[model samples]
Target: MGHDLNLNAMNYFEAVARLGGVSKAAEELGVSASAVSQQIRQLEQQFGVRLFRREKRRLILTLDGERLFQTTTQAFRMMRDVRSAIVRQRENRHFIMRVSPSFGVRWLAPRLKGFLDANPGWDLRVDGAPDFSDFETEIVDLDLRYGAGDWSGLHQEAVVHDFVLPMCSPSYLAELKEQSGDPIGQLLKARLIDSVKTHFRWDFWLARHGAMGGRMVYPLRFDRSNMAIQVAADGAGVVLESATLAINELERGDLVPLSRAFAVIKVPTYWLVCPSRHTNRRIVRLFSEWMRKEGSAHDDKTADMLRSLGCTIQEEESTILNRDIDDARQ
Candidate 1:
């Protein structure tokens, strides 16, 4: 309604919208409840719109409120990031590491503390980006990417050569077992989760086992391995993904092997990739070393779990999908 944007009102509104109540927003903002409420009322009047629908003390955003809140939240986040970047620039010994979103969220994120505690007086930023990072342009110090080592001119090390297997929730497995006695037949009838960006796919696994019958087409397809694994954990369907990434879920008994046929296809699951010039950074080497150890620990645990599940493991020999080049297309 005014020529200039009302920053204070917007900030107050964002706090209430995010916190779900005016009193909580006031408490966090170190302001009185009435002051917060006044800001909200003024904001509503300026826009000439009802922002929130009060439902038993919970502030539910209306359509217009939801739209404004989205923009405000993004703006605040951008401000925070800019501030952090500026602060890091003033400080020395800061490094940026890029990782695949799926791997970073499910696997590396939980184990990040070990590397930090071992090495202090340094700043480390972990970016879980879907796209492969352009090291030169992005100013990335380290990279953990999922793919076969195919990036030319880059010094790379296999973080862990991972194992892919068909895993599903306990409830889904029981329901799945009722459909067919034959393991292969059951998979054929069920919806298989296909992670399109991943090197190890459902078709490859099926073909390796010689169960290449029926449509062999997946109904549930996701771009990230973590997404497929999560849906499978929630009893959606059987997901063919890295057991290493699904360690927490497996440890929690959220997901189990669909069959006793354990698999260890030496396909590259994740790699510690960086430019040749950046390889010698002590921080990078230490992080890489820590990651490899963690990966080995994951493998050992996975192997023991598979054995407990009464599985007969087999290592498959096949070509792999090139990481940087092939993944860029998807």
Candidate 2:
């Protein structure tokens, strides 16, 4: 056995072990499959142990491989943590935040310019993805997550409670006005735009409103709620989505509510989450305060808008865990 193992080969082996195949690890590492295979072979020879056994085209890790993987995984994570900490300390004026794509596009992206303008010296990096940020190992300082606001081992504050209802373009509604006497019935008869990714399913909304039995064919299914909303605004079909994501379009007269019946799915509230230890960071604290303020303002405005539309706003039990401070030292 070699006295010193190659760190690079160990990394390749880790990637293969994590991904469960040489080809996948190669793609992720941006190297050829043969290259990754060679590295694994080198590592096994160096360690004097078989790391993986081939089984039905998949790389199955052996007992020694599992032990080595455990060590390397922790080591890489620690390395990333150390690197992130140093970079953050050096770039104290920068803040990294993560949010789901739909919220990022429809809600936060439009408001980001104002936030940046107010804090001229601060640099913000926003990542838009469905997955939550790993605060312990990743560089993300804060996250806007859509969930129950009950994630364990994290400091969380509810940013917004979203209520979903049927919405469609004015042109589409005008077209359907002659066909059906009931508004809900018209919506059910029209082409439906469904979001496959959201917990607020069209079936659930339909069943709640007593229209589940109606035979409606969804021609288009989108993975993102924002995309579904856009399709609805284009007069393509009727969509059921969060009012928060459609606020701008609705206010702009691009879309209108189809019915007064709305469902407040309590499981998917937007939350401002961060590691409990990082809540004390100056930038995190400032960003958290700003988000809470914006959230409150949006909620108030949305409630007013709903009232004007004669749509019932179903309120969820408040999940806000923090109170606004008169003065927070940045």
Q: Evaluated with lDDT, which candidate comes out highest?
A: 1
As a whole number from 0 to 100, the lDDT of residue 64 in candidate 2 is 98
Instruction: List TM-score per model, in order.
Output: 0.67, 0.65
Question: RMSDs, each prediction?
Answer: 14.9, 17.4
- Give candidate 2 misplaced runs (Cα > 4 Å): 1-92, 214-217, 261-268, 318-330
Question: Each prediction's Cα lDDT score?
Answer: 0.81, 0.79
Worst 10 residues of 2 by lDDT: 321-330
In the range 221-323, model 1's lDDT, one tens digit per residue, is 9998878888999999988887777877887899988887545444555788889888688888788788889887877777777677676565532243443
Give the per-residue Cα lDDT of candidate 2 at 322: 18
Residue pairs of candidate 2 with colliding backbone atoms: none
